[model samples]
Target chain A: MSRYLAAVVLLAGLAHPAVGAAQAAQNATLRRAQQAYDNLEYRQVLTLARAALRERLTGAERARAYELLGFTYGAMDSILKAVDAFKQVVLLDPERQLDPNRVSPKAYSAFDVALRQVLLVRQLRVDSVSFVGGQGAVPVRFTVTQPARVVARAIGSGATVVIDSGAWNGQVNLRWPARLPGGDPVPAGTYTLVVDARLGQNTFSASQPIRVSHGRVDTLPSVTSLPGYQFLPETEIPPQSWRPVGLAFLYTGGALVGTLGLESSSLGSSSKRELGLVGGAALVTGFVMMLRKPAARPAQANILYNHLLRDQIARRNQDIAKENVARRQQVQVTVAPVSPVTPK
Target chain B: MTRAALGPLLLALALRPAAGQLVAVGPQFVLADYREVASGLRYRGNGFGGALWARRNRFSVEAAVVRLSFDPVAGSAADSGFTATQVDAWVAYDVAAYASIEVGVLHRSVDPEFDAQSVGALRVGARSFYQIGPGATVVFRANYLAAPKFSGGGHAAVSLDLGLGLDVRLAGRLHGTATYAFNRMNRRTNPGGTGEIDAPIQETVARLGLALGF
Candidate 1:
């Protein structure tokens, strides 16, 4: 039963041979160390991995050497030494990760302990954003491996702007308004967002490149009229009636009565020929007019309503003009992440 | 009044370049009836005239001049006839949308000197006007003749005049006009301080014309 449990433990540790496949070593010693680790030769892995570490290697190969040493130590039941080796592995590549489901529990535990021991900022990200100046901010997120004093900054175009500074650990989120202390947006150009974490003698940083651009802020349009309101006609046609002919008859009758009453008795009755001629013409004109369409007259209520609507539209346009003027003086700011340059 | 004063006045009013001013000028055909003292002393005549009207703002002016030659009608007790020249003028101010108060003068002269009464009087009156249709109006007026002077020398206790008028715009800037007027004067004269005797005069005139509006 003891031998069977030993075989099961060896199979579990060798389950993730593909983990090192992507980092095929160019150096003969590191290649031998990786082969020995895959063969479950823990003693040979420890010797060969330590020897490969002594040789000058690429940064990736060096991290691979340390990872092999960590797994070899965990298979030999030396948890302290395994954790020490993983610490070196994470220091060489802060973003290095080991899957707990594919690796031995002991190796995964040591890797976790190594991550907790280091002071590093990992997975730094800057999300693309656009906003009117002073209205919004850019989103930034990262992870810190240990409790540390973390400072985030943007440096470019001969200027360095500090984004945030605090003592924090684990996952951290920040918002950068990308404005100056005077409430103005920064000049447009390519910039590097750098995050630094320091814990006593140990320190690590991560960086991302971002681009800032400027654009004209959209202005509001002036209104010509209000919604749901309209102007009405200022004149209306009156209804047709017999008032014209009636008035003509009344006036003619008045003239006739007055003439008859004012006649002098000595002169008897004056001739009616003059009255017959003119009064006949008046009566005819009046009768014709009564049959005609009435003329349009002023609509007082509609005129007043149209005047008020025009006033309201004028006021609205004035307000829009003022807002457009303000918008013309402001700027739109856009920020987006770009492919990073080589970090120093 | 001479034609010289009246002609220039009408010309100036027509030529004045004032906003909202209306001016109309026309020739008129006139029909008139005249009687003196007794019904038998009557004459009927036809004549010609000219009329001018101008309005600006709420004020208006109107003038008419006619010349008529008359002969006694059939069975009349008159041996001769007369020629008469009459002038009438008024200046009015609107008191309401359709009403106005006016002051004016009327003067008539006879060519035969004594064949008929030559009268002059100051007129004070009120008129009402209404628009019967598009570009059509009717007017009526009543006047109290005050301070009368007659060529034959008379004192008039009461005198009155009444008129009716019509204007229709027949076409662009062209108008048709018609007017009728009647006046009566009650005069008492003491010839050589003999006794008071009644001598009254009455006349009726009709005018029809076409006016050019500006």
Candidate 2:
């Protein structure tokens, strides 16, 4: 009985080796698939990989099978199927890499496409907002997965201005003139900068807000102080139909007439002479007045007006500060690159 | 009024209805000091006046009239003062946001013909402005004035006007304007002309006014 038991144990060990051999044989399908892909027998590689996937393979083995399937499909120009297979490879072992020496450039490029299709990521950035001369412009930057059509629009309170529209590829940098198509400065207000990119049937868009400040028009009472003067000085007043010299001439003529009247029968010679002297004095005074200009008073009013103006300026500065705060609140600018939205 | 005097008023009225035009009118306070070499007299006074300014795009017209009374000076036997009026029109071309070059015509008159002075001139100038704060600007201007025998005396003169000014917003379309200017008038002596006895004059003017926009 002991001899029989020893022989049976040896047979059991042999049976264990047979089971291991069967498992090894089953794993060989993935290895064969890899070899087939190397030999350029893409159809055979697909068949072997499919069979290996059907069985319960180890994680590493499953990844290798998927990689082989992807390469085979790519070689056959079956891009979508190859992409689908490559996705599986990544799912199994994300750290896998196809050897550059062994893989064709086209296959690698197709794999890249597959990766982007599976995880779409794109971004748009508003590089800057600036002005040239009096014309304003904005700079935009974006990365493209492929060739695409790009359009930018600046929307303002009363108008929608299209800044850019064209086909582009790769990394794109564009400068958009901040005026309407008609080449007029946009009216002042808050504006939205929107960028849209179309890649085949996919569309992506982003927006940011900016402020355009032309000078503001105000309509308040004047801050300048009024002068306290019964009448403006001759030097400071505007031209008039009547002048001081003319009045002087009239006064002198009236004095001469009074002297003449005194010279007539009713007045004594002494009175007449006195009247004549008065007329002569009046004439001389009028002539002097005509020759001499009228001087003005001191400029106290101007000093007061300037003081008021300075106060107004200080107050306006405060108002501007408040306006700046409000403008900051209105301007919602985002410059960070954003993750791409999945296509519907 | 003479045609020359009426021309500016008519132009302002016409432009008042136009779009993008600004018209401002207000009372002004003025302080001025003047020195005449021939008379060896120094005249100084303060006065009130009115100013009108019309602006459209790069073009502008400004007019001001003031009356000034002088203190009794030793050289003159009588008190001397005069009403002065000025009108100017200019077009400005901007080279930068804060600077501009301008060319214009100016007309000036002094009542009672003090020293037989004439004021018509061709003006060339430059102006610069800086925004120190919101609704406020500090402005500087310099101009070369060439008068080519505009006075009947057949005497030509050249002058310079240097100005510093400030504009402060008061309310909607209303602003306060304050300016200080220095003027140097150099008269050319005609060899045997009776009016040639006058000497160069240096004047300083300070003005403050309210400006309104239409």
CAPRI band for model 1: medium
Give native contacts recovered, as a fraction, per prediction.
0.86, 0.00
For residues A128-212, could you state the per-residue lDDT of candidate 1 as single tens digits? 8998898899999999988999999999894679999999999999999999877789899989999988889877889999999
Per-residue lDDT over A1-344 for candidate 2, one digit per residue giving the tens place of the 0 to 100 score: 99989645543432231232234444877767656655556678789889999989987677667766666676677878888887776555543445544456556776677655532214455654434323445576655545668787877786898877888765677766556557655666776767676877877565666666544333244333334422323234223322333443444344334333322121112122322333343334334434544434245566566666667666766677776665443422222222332222
Candidate 2: tens digits of C-alpha lDDT, residues B1-214: 9999898775565344333537777777776665544444555566777777776666555666666554534654346655556555556666676787888766656666753355677878887755433344555667787663435344435577665555655565666766655555665565475555435555566677776657
Error of 2 at A87 (Å): 36
Error of 2 at A319 (Å): 45
Show where candidate 1 strays beyond 4 Å.
A1-178, A191-210, A217-235, A298-327, A334-344, B1-21, B38-40, B73-79, B195-197
Best by lDDT: 1
lDDT of each: 0.87, 0.57
TM-score of chain A, model 2?
A: 0.31
